[model samples]
Target: MARKISAPSLFQLGYYWEAKIFLTSVKLDLYTPLAKGPKTAKNLAGLIEADTDALTRLLDALVSIGLLRREGDAYANIPELAEFLAKTSRFYMGELMLLQDAEWDHWGKLEDIIKTGKPTVQDNIFMNTPELGATVSKVLHRMAKRVAPALAEKIDLSDYKTLIDVGGGGGAFTIAFCQRYPHIKASLFDLPQTLKVAQENIAQAQLNHRIELIEGNFNTGPLPGTYDVVFASDILHYQTEAENAALVKRLYDATEPGGFIIIKDMFIDDDENEPGWNAVFSIHMMVYSEKGRCFQGKKIRDWMTQAGFDNIVEIEKNTILAGTKGV
Candidate 1:
């Protein structure tokens, strides 16, 4: 007799419950304390000021989800969680996780968005809220610190002297590039409030002299200055296709003859079928913004070519694309 196959697990709704639990843990600053060492439920409760029984249950759930580990009656963060989830760690992701926690409210309106085919809110609440904006900026800065080093290694900046990081939040890429190439000077273009956060980060990096913060809305006007390298990372998905094309034309004009233009974003395939994350993110854009959606890499490349870019290359498995303007 053939072995019976169990029905596929259909705990789809459980994902949100699990996420809520994880977010609650991060909100309470549980992982940071666990980073010190293993501790019992009572000890953790005292450290984070939570109810002992309640905290223990949450810890047990985290352990089941593989975020924490249990040995006997003590609980501790897993190695990966300790490094990235602990508030004290350099690459701490608590702020980003908290941002998601805040988004839970927005996400709750997804059913309505799907039905109405429109965003429930007119503007991004997080951007409108100053405190939330600052938190988001800090998270972006930390994420950039992680990605920038790899980006610097992949791209050659020896010949590039001046760079314009359009819509550059937190100035993480600029700081990383400037540190890697001592001769490079970068200007970070963003809104006034975001530039404030970027300024603080640049000062902290001690690259204040090298990275200049320029305040403007790139969506409405042309870039302020010409640059040897124009870089925009994770900015394209926030606009419609026509807007991105127009922006690419503007970026081309901002680029010096023979200069380079680099666009780093989550680009989907032409069919928009493969790369599951890109597809899901396309929906995320739909729910978040009125016109934003992930664009096809081929379409973006075609736009570059039409704008007089030459020798375009896709790197980092199509996440980063670069093209050079004719001299």
Candidate 2:
């Protein structure tokens, strides 16, 4: 008898249904209301102003998907959903989910992008819309908060006094570092409109007095000032290889002697293949940016070495790189 191979992987291709269900639930503000307590589908429909029959089915789907729990006719959020999906939770991910909902339009044109090698939507749409920018900034800030404590623990910043966050959209990492080391004052550099969002976040973190906001484009102009530490997260993938090399050189010159420059972004293998998530993100960069793509860790290391940085260290499974400036 011949061995048989299964094709259950084909079902993964239809995973968009799961995404749509979750996005729809978020758009309906379902989880937030459920955060209050369990409610029957009919009661939830009345509260969220939806048709009871339709909502019942949707609620059942949510329960099946493990985003919500069902007891008889009552539907309630699971613990994970209650914490991260509920709008009342500080870690709410609804804004990012909503942004992904908007990106569905661009993702729908993947075929056009593949054929023409051109983006169907404007790349700077977020920057052009204040509301969208703020939403994205808030989401990014929350994400940074989630990762910052572990990151701060990994890297020693005791000796560092001043820091600059290049293209630091909402000052999440800045606030985190400052909170971890109360003696460290930081500067956040970003676009004027982006800085507005960062200012609000920084003020909320109560680091307004410690974190100064600098409004400018690092690509077009010089960085604000020299610092003991320079950090850039999720920003380098927006530039070309040559541009990144140039930017690294500029950052090198701006780094104080014996200081550190840290970069955190999704990086692909040297072959630019494998790591399914990074490969998909490379495609996303192709559609969203003219010159951006997921760069290789080796190339980033080369850039840092060429810029006179030594003691380069790869951390977080190569998602982050830190280089030391020689004294």
Candidate 3:
């Protein structure tokens, strides 16, 4: 008989360990200082306001988790981690760490949520107020500004002139695309408060002339007239299957013939266990938003087809579904 297999506990322990590291590193801005150059423990101790011994331990822990790299007795931030995790970098995930912490706080009470079949997050925290919701929405847009631009180049946006970025946080995709393809004019649509930040971000990028900012809830509000492409990044996962289908159909109607729609979000593989991010993201969606859940690309493809889109293909692009509308 074949030997019984077992999963490793290292990963579970590592998860908690990494959580601590991420929390602390973001708190101390460790990556930013070291991003300037490798620094000795003494320097970091002063910067973090901790004792040499405690700082050394924290640095070692971060190094062990691969968030930091040690050179001899000094420490340096890993390039990728420095760029994305450091507070000083444009791609900083520090605020996102706080958002993740907020989500995990709700996850701590998941047992009760499961028992009552009730939603949490915005209910227990954030006061369920429109203003607070707007604040969190801006934070999310800031997050999009940090993470989405890096992935922008991975897709081909050269062909389209007018594009609509649905739920575009901070208008990052539009900023990046405008910088790359000077001819591609873009529009961003989101909640009013969120659009406020998106407009500022676009202006800061000095691309205000290239992009338009519109405020409206995609589900209930009227979409702007036809465009060459409608791109939904980190937007669709927050809706139910039926709602996503409806929105896809709506996007199809709003798109001119031969135009395309892009749906980008996390997805699970058919086997259900592959690509670990999908599994974690599913739980995250449950804790964070109502009717949100990570899904499979195949199911999404079906939804696209049902919504009357053609040329549906899961290209080598980032976790996105791109398809064209037939005349």
Please name the candidate that would achieve the greatest TM-score relative to the true structure.
2
lDDT of 3 by residue, 129-232 (tens): 55655556666666666656665676777787888888886677778777877889888887776777777778888988889988777887458888888888
How much is 72 displaced in model 1, in angstroms? 4.2
Residue-level error in angstroms, candidate 1, position 25:
1.0
lDDT of 2 at 128: 51
Clashing pairs in 2: none
lDDT (Cα) of model 1? 0.84
The lowest-lDDT stretch of 10 consecutive residues in candidate 2 is 1-10
Per-model lDDT: 0.84, 0.84, 0.76
What is the Cα-based lDDT of residue 57 in candidate 2?
Answer: 90
Over the full model, what C-alpha lDDT does candidate 3 score relative to the true structure?
Answer: 0.76
lDDT of 1 at 261: 94
What's the residue-level lDDT of 97 in candidate 3? 75
Give the runs in model 3 whose Cα sits over 4 Å from its true position. 1-11, 14-18, 28-85, 114-116, 122-160, 273-276
Off by over 4 Å in 1: 1-9, 12-15, 46-49
Name the lDDT value of residue 274 in candidate 2. Answer: 46
